[model samples]
Target: MRPLVLLDVDGVLNPIGRRPPGYRRYRCVVEGVTYVVSLDPRHGRRLLGLAEATGAELVWATTWEEHANDWIAPRIGLPSLPVVAVNADTLPVSGHGEMFKTPAVAAYAGLRPFVWFDDQVWAEDEEYLRVHQGVGDFLLVHVDPAHGLTSDHLGMAKEWLTLTGFSQGS
Candidate 1:
């Protein structure tokens, strides 16, 4: 089975603050909420390349939910991808300091190895995935809200994908 690359939009593809030069900006309204986002088109190509090299599937794990396909993907030159159902704006309600989406993400991943990219992922979230029963290998990439996803983050995911025995299969 192919591993999964879980993508977060707000802080991964779209920066929460100042972005690298030449990023395309968009004013999006989802469910009556306005969001102004900045995205580098190059990120789409890079993410696609990483998926191809690792025989992984790119899945959305953002709170943008289904709107990622409509508002986020095309802005960054990516196609619509499967989304992990996550509750938005929710704090760590489990009391273990884990993000609210942890349980849902773990369920979606099941036995598949996954690389998660998000600004919010913390050590606690990693531990939650690590200790999840019947869970597969996972890499939590903490993206900077200020800088967004970088080559360094992608490199880490690439390395971990190899370590997880990823095969570039047709």
Candidate 2:
């Protein structure tokens, strides 16, 4: 099976503060409710291209969920892909609130090898990795707002694929 790449919309693909003035905030009406948002379009395009180049399946691991597809995907030059929506009403784990994405990602991809790109991962993520070490290939990648996806992050992803013996074309 092809490996999965769980993408976080807000901070990973879309930088928080890098877009233009008005474009910075996206307003939308979902099921009769209106909302506003902001995102970085340039980096989001790069991330989409990367997904196409790597032959990895993309799944949304974002809080925006259906809203991401309706509002964010088109802005970033990406068409709709599978999305994993978190339970919005639930309270996050006390200290590791960021790690909430982990369970959604794990459920969405099943046992497929996956690389998670998000600004939000915590000590609980490390613990999840340790506990699930024997289940399937999984890599947690932290993308910084300042640098986007750095060489180190890409290298680590490439290394994971290489170590798993997955061949790439050029």
lDDT: which candidate is best? 1
User: lDDT per prediction?
Assistant: 0.87, 0.66
What number of clashing residue pairs does each candidate have, in the order they appear?
A: 0, 1
| Candidate 1 similarity to native, TM-score | 0.93
Best by TM-score: 1
| Per-residue lDDT of candidate 1, residues 88-147 (tens digit) | 465335678898888889989998989999999999998988887988988999999888
lDDT of 2 by residue, 20-82 (tens): 432456677877988655555654566555566666777788887877778878876678878
In angstroms, give how far residue 165 of model 1 lies from its true place: 0.8
For model 2 the TM-score comes to 0.73
Model 1 local distance difference test score: 0.87
